[model samples]
Target: MYIRDVTKVDIETVARISVEGWRHAYRGIIDDAVLDGRSVGEAARQWQEWLEDLVRRGDRLAVADDAGQVVGFASYGANRDQDNGFDAELYAIYVDPDRLGRGIGTALVRDMGRWLEAHGYEDVVVWCLKANPWCRFYGRSGARPVAQRIIEIGSRKLEEIGYGWHTMATLREE
Candidate 1:
């Protein structure tokens, strides 16, 4: 697999990964009606627009491409939260369900740190649904559980936990 900055050509695959990945990740945790109600086409369009904005703003969106096919992605930028004391925030990371457990997610996270480090960001933060088993991935990568909050989605209140790395050095492979 190869990692690179996202381009227009990757929009569709990224969207598909986002929609399907979210469905897979949130399956049992979120209300079925709400999760199942998501529209792939809509999600694609929104992702396309979001990608454009990220590119325009000089933020980073990296994809894990396997032989020309995008199988995963990670987006990061300046922290959006107030007084979070983090230089950068990992807004999202998703791999195609079929591609999970192949080290693609780990590679993406490491690449994200390299990209952020190049941009002068030392500390990184990420938020994941508290119920997501994948949340443990961050911990395994050496991020510390730093905070938590409740977010509402389609009439359901879900808890999210924040994981933080005081420095990206920990993400480097031995």
Candidate 2:
């Protein structure tokens, strides 16, 4: 497996994996219609726009590849949290359903943290659904839940938890 910066060529693959990962990971948690009607093409277009902006700004967008295929991807930048404490935020992290449990997610996050640290960020934060067990992975990776909120998407109100890692030292040690 190889991890590197995302390119325009990876947009479609990342979008597909993002859609599939959402469908599999949020099956019972979110509205079924949302996942069922997810448009990979729209996602790809959105990724293209995002990539263009990232390239212009020189921001970090990382992808994991196996056998030349993108299996996972993550995007990070300055903290978007309104409270504005952490230096960085993990905007998104999605792994192909077939690649789950293979440490791809972990590697993506660890690398995101490393990138943040290298770029002068003192802390990194990520938001996840409170009901998702993936929080365990974050906990094990040295991030602790620091905040919570209920966010409404469509007609559903979902619990969102924010996790923060103050430094990359713990991820590095792992």
By lDDT, the best candidate is: 1
Per-residue alpha-carbon lDDT of model 2 for 11-120, expressed as tens digits? 89999998898888888898988888889999899889988887787678899988899999999888877594787888888889887889998898878877878888
Candidate 1 structure quality by residue, lDDT tens digits, 1-174: 989988888888888888888889999888888877778888888988898888888898899988999999999988989587887999999999998888998999888888899899989999999999999899888899999999998778999999999988998864
Which candidate wins on TM-score? Answer: 1
Cα-based lDDT at residue 136, candidate 1: 88
Worst 10 residues of 2 by lDDT: 78-87
Shift in Å, residue 22, candidate 2: 0.6
Error of 1 at 73 (Å): 0.4
- Candidate 1 Cα lDDT to native: 0.89
Which residue pairs of candidate 1 clash?
A: none
User: Candidate 2: deviation at residue 87, Å?
Assistant: 1.0
RMSD, model 1, all Cα superposed?
1.0
Where in model 2 is the C-alpha error above 4 Å?
82-84
